[model samples]
Target: MFSRLIRAALLAATPLSVSAAPVPANDAQRGLAALQAMDARVAAVGERLAVRGAPLCGDRQMRSGLLVHGLAQYAPAARADAAALFGLGDAPAVLAVVPGSGADRAGLQAGDAIIAVEGDDVATATAPQGAARFDAVQRVEDRIEAGLADGALSLTIRRDGRERAVRVTGDEGCASRFQMIPATRLNASAGPYVSVTSAIVEFVASDDELALVLAHELSHNILKHGARLDRQGTSRGLLRAFGKNPGRIRATEDEADRMALYLMARAGYDIAVAPAFWDRFGRRTGFGMFSDRTHSGRRDRMALAVREIALIRAQQARGEAPTPDFAGR
Candidate 1:
């Protein structure tokens, strides 16, 4: 909801394996960690969907802004196998890219090793890839973000041993960014950025459900719901220590719910999963429809999603693209 992932490649110096009997508890933790890393692919799906859908729905009300290279998750690799897959000879490799995004338009193909940025060797910008690939990825991301302010960035892509310098433009969307936090809590929230818990990532049944959740938080970003609430003077004192204003929170939830489904529709995700997720989410949390002050009941949210999805389908049937109704929201 807030930002993204950089699925980079890594070269395992040697395969780490152990006997099955009497394994250490840390082994389970390590297994879970690896699963979490791979499972996070869902975040990229949400990003690509949002990149495509949100702008289409909101022309001026929202903006056709926020250009992205659409690359997600990257890592440094040295092995010939890694080099072959990433299309680089021991360089930074991309994991995924959003279709039709600024990066896509610039021909910044996924898996192309970004060997350099603006003539500066990208490898020099990143941290030493000692034991973990993430360390290297972090350095590259920092270098990449530093270049974002330049409005346009030159990336050196290596494919089949040939290098090409591609320049990509940048655009602004909502002020919100994205982050995936480490927690098992099956929920997401947004303000300056969309924050999705690791728990939510593990809990979702499919990419469709995950995208719906992401779109909901991304919707909060697009609508500027958080800033608007703060502007309304929803107390920042003990009220914050307690909980948010129920009325204000509920209103924002309504808007987020509506806009999220349309985003899913435009992104080509199955909106049918939206309501199902809420039904499962509410039941697991023991939160009732009309019972929570900050959110509508599960039944209410799901029903609304259903209605809007149908409306979206009808619009498409009529050969008209549905736009987010931001009149009051």
Candidate 2:
């Protein structure tokens, strides 16, 4: 009986392995060499695009203490696409509050469940379109700006099952500019920009998931992987510059995977979710390059992401400090 119970417990704890063949050693080496060359060429291009002495945190002059970093506010219905992907049910409630923004000062939390906005029943409102979400919020703001409301907009919320009314003042901060671009192929050396042939930002599972993706991309920028690859050698640079390279792209992707894991954790997103996101993405997209110019097929990319997540879990088990907030005030 004891043995049977132990076996069951172990089986329950095991993560299922993805069935896919690893890239061949020779192929891997060639890919790595190609990646190095691409990195050098990309670095040259990035250097030209790099804005000198740009402050990490731009001027914070919003009435709301919130700083938008690569993100934009939308109505609850506009976020339906993401909500469906996350399995948050048909109509999940969403609320936005920047750390130092008016919403924060007015006492709003990230996960706050909003019941009503300015006496309108949010739950029953029409499902918002992509652009309509921002439009709705702007309408509320316009009312305030035109001196229609007293001082604060009335918001009814259900937190921990209890109903409460809160007043929120409108203020602004840096607009969040994060977006996901889909492309048949992209130059890894492009620096901080991921190209998508066709994609939509609203497809992400959650705001946290969106943040995780952006954080990972930002990690590449912070680590200077492009510059590091440039130091690797010459032939690699030539291929990457002309965008005919495949190997170097794979190497840069691997580095970005590792870096993204670190960045997401630090950004306070559930680190485990990152792997799950990639796994789903792989299933939908298939294993291999999107096109010949793309490197690191789906199988390899998914596997590497899983490995990184495991490393993060191990670090957490050792009682490491949580990732600090990289989004500055």
**Model number with the top lDDT:** 1
Against the true structure, what is each candidate's TM-score?
0.64, 0.40
Cα error, candidate 1, residue 145 (Å): 5.7
Instruction: Give the true-structure RMSD of model 1.
Output: 8.3
| Model 1 misplacement above 4 A | 1-40, 56-116, 120-152, 156-179, 236-244, 287-292, 326-329
- Return the lDDT, model 2, position 111: 35
Report the lDDT tens digits of candidate 1 across residue range 182-222: 55456677654466776787788987887788788878767
Off by over 4 Å in 2: 1-198, 230-244, 283-289, 322-329
lDDT of 2 by residue, 1-329 (tens): 00001000000000011221112245433332233222222222222112110122242112322111100232343233333221122122332233333556677543345556677665433234444233333343333333313445676766556778887664332212212222233212223232211121334565455544555454445555456656655134335534434565556556666666665565455667766776666565564334544446566766877877777777788897433232311
